[model samples]
Structures are given as C-alpha cells and as structure tokens.
Target: MSSRIPITLAGLAIVLSTASALYSAHALREQQQLVDHLNGQVARIQPYAFSRSDLDALLSRQSLAVAPPAAPEAPPAPMKRESAPIVGERRYGDATAQFSLIEYSDFECPYCKQYFAVPKAVVDSSRGNASVVFKHVPIHGEASRREAFAAECAAAQGGNDAFYRMAGAIFSSTAGNGTGTEKPLAVIASSIGLDGAALSRCIDNQEPLQKVKADFREAVELGIKETPTTIVRHNPSNRQVVLSGAKGPEDILRAMAKLVQGNGAAQ
Candidate 1:
C-alpha cells in the first residue's frame, strides 16, 4: 500500500507541472497576440493621422458640440420657446436665413474652445446663406457664469460684434482655467475695443442676467449637462435637429445636407 501511495503522488505532481507549463505558454501567446494586434492598429492609424487643426476641422464637421446632461430635466418653459432671444443676446448673420444653428456653450469648456473656429468658418462659408444663433448656458464654474453675463452685457451694449468679439476672444485664446479668472470675459470685451463702461454696466445690471438665467434654465430642460449643445433649426418648417457632443465637422456637414434633402423631399 505504501509503495502504491508514492507512485500516485509522483503521478499527480507530474500532471500538475504539465498543466502549469501549458497555462503559462498559453498566456504568453495571448499577450503576444494582443501586442501584435495593437501594434498593427497603431501602424494603420499612424499614416492617416492629421494635425490638430486638421483634426479639429474634421471633428468640427461631425456636429458633436455637447453632450446631454446625465440627469435631464424639463425646462421651466418650452425649451424651443422659453429661451427665445431677448434684446441682449448674441446673434450672427441674417434674421431671415433659411436655417439657424443654435449653440449652447460654456466658455470654459476646452471642447467649446475647439469648436469656436468651426462656427466662424461655417459663418464665413455661408456668406449670407445661413445664420448662427448664440446662447450662453454657462455650465462650468463661476467664471463661466461671469463670462456669460459679460457676453450678454456686450451684446446688449455693443451688439453682435461685441458679443462675437468677446466670445471669440475668450474661446480663441487657450488662456483660462475654465474659470473666468484666467481670461476674464470683461478683458475679452476690452480686447475687442468695446466700451468698458458699458460692458461693466451690462455685467452689473440684472436684465441681461435674467435673460442668461432663463437660457440656463432652458438648457437644463433640454437635458444639456455638457459644454456645447447645438440645435439646428430649419426655419421654413420649424424642424429641429438636436446634436449633442463634441463631434466632427464632417458629421455636421452631412447632417445639414441630409436635413436639407429631407426637407426638400417633404416640400
């Protein structure tokens, strides 16, 4: 019996050793395969890569400007109606253009900063064909809220140019900490050559503040919890296309084209 017990123990050890060796070999092969696959993908992407500007251009056309708020709640009033532009908000292009892109952005968001150039290009490309309606929904921190008020003040006093300038300056420069502190909205207004006193007065006043608050409420209602949420509206039929995210520009162009086609077909 003792002799048989020794034989059984030896056999068990050998089997265990063989299994462990096989398992180690399998794991090594899997690791190698994973590495090889990753390398191949990297190589594939390396050749077709783009510069930051080029990447941004590509990203801009894809139509992702903001993400919907994680916990979306209905706005106090109809989002489409309640946040209607008052006297002091920033607006660009014709009041009667066939289509309008409404952008709800936080000045502090890096993605919003990246998207800033896109609207400029789109506006320039439109050449009186389309218009962009701007709204301030400062969802970041205190500085963003301050800038929102400043933008409103600029729009109220200096009009679209002032507001545009302030927005452009703030978004164009990568100088802030997502708080209005690093690049104060007031300074941006000053850089654009707007009247300092008027900008200050606009910021200090409550009317513009109220308008901004209304828009923020509207944004909440629309489930906008992120930096940039864009609503593309076809003016003729009052159709709505809600695009949420910091998507690529190509996507935006495609969506716009598809929208135009669909609208044309419906007509």
Candidate 2:
C-alpha cells in the first residue's frame, strides 16, 4: 500500500508539470499573434507620415506663395507754354521796339509791388530796344480784381498813359496783401489826375471788367501761375524767355540780351 501510494504521488506530480507547460505554450502563441497584428498596423500607416524636414519645406513653400504690396505713384509735372503771350494795347516804351516784356502782374502781391518799376526801368534803359506789355493776373480776390478794372477804366477814359499812371498809383498807394489803399478808389483816381466821377461811372457800369477778364484769361492761357512773371519776347523772331518771380532790371536786361544774341539780330 505504501508503494502504491508513492507511485500515485509521482504520477500526479508529472501530470501537473505537463499541464503547466501546455498553458505556458498557449499564452506565448497568443502574445506572438498580438505583436504581429500591431506590426501590420504600423506598416499600413508608415506611407502617410511626414518627417520634420518635409513639414518645414511645406511651410516654407506656403510662405513663399503670398505676394507683397504695391508701391504708390508720383505727382504730375507743371504745364509749359506752347506759344508766346499776346502784347495788347496796354504797352510801355516804343511800340516798334524789337523786344516786348510781357509782364503778368497782381496788384495786391508784395512781390509784384517790388518788381513794379523793374519792367519800366528795363524799357527806359533799353533806349527803344525793349518794351513792356502789362497784363492782369489779379489772383488776390475782389480787391485786386477791382483795381485791375480801375486800371482798365483809366485806359478807357484817358488812353494807355492813364492806364500806366493808375497802375503805378495803385502799386504805390496799396498797403498790399489785398488791403488796398487807405483812400477810396475814386480818390486815388483823382490824385492821379483822372476824373474821379468818370472812373466811378466806368467801374459801376462794369465796362472795363471785360478787358480785365480778357487779360486774366490770356494770363491763364499763357500758363502764368504767380505774380511778376515776365515773358521776354523778340517780336521779329517770336522767340521768348520766361522770367519767373521778382526779377531785377539787370536780370531782365540780361535775359533780353540772351534772346537778342540767340536771334543774332541787331539790338
């Protein structure tokens, strides 16, 4: 009985060992299957994945695709004259003079006042070689326009000499910057030996307003922008030089000399 008991114990131990071995083998096979399935999933997703350098290159390409903003445009240039300005009846110096200094002036302009005597001085010095033509710009509003009309009215009553006298008196008497004279326009007219009542009548009737408007229109057509713009013209050759701003008599004479030299005509 003791021997049979020993044999039974040994057989039971062997059976237990065999069962533990089989269970371990089964667990190992299942674990191997799970590893294979995970490896298959990783293989399938590998083609769609991006590297760090590839992502950086794609971002760089996107950044380069956008365009930059445009730059602003520049301003246009000022206009130039195509033809010479007209020299009408309001002229000083010899009518048959070789050169005409077409002076486009404003009454209320201080610069115009400074340059008022310059054209006359040039004419006086030229000795019948150069003349001056007075044209109104009147850029200083109503006061200037009225004075322009007054000068034209003086011309209408007393001819070109009266016109020049009125212009000179207006320039001499005005406070400038459109303040005009302390005295009345009629009083100013009378002081210059013009009939005050007749001058007033002409201003009221607006007879000389057309002439002033014509002068202003001519100035604009000639592209005279500012006060004291003198166009030194050779009447024989129709050659001209533009003298802008408040030019001295010497400067005007120099420009005239150039024009004369350019023409090769005797002065």
lDDT of 2 by residue, 1-267 (tens): 887998999999999999999999997776455345434433443232211111111111211111333544765454342222212479988989878999988788777887888789767766577788998877666678778878887887677898899999999888777787777788999998988877777765556655676777776667666667888888877788887778766566656656645543332
lDDT of 1: 0.61
Highest-scoring model, TM-score:
2
Predicted candidate 1 versus true structure: per-residue lDDT over 1-267, tens digit per residue = 988999999999999999999999997786465445434433443231212221212222222123344664654542332222446446688878666777877776667776765655555555454577787766555566667777777666667877787777767754444545455455666778876665665554434666777677767667665556677776766666776655444434444554554442331
Clashing pairs in 2: none
Q: Give the range of the ten consecutive residues with the poorest summed lDDT in model 2.
A: 51-60
What's the TM-score of every candidate structure? 0.62, 0.65
lDDT values for all models: 0.61, 0.71
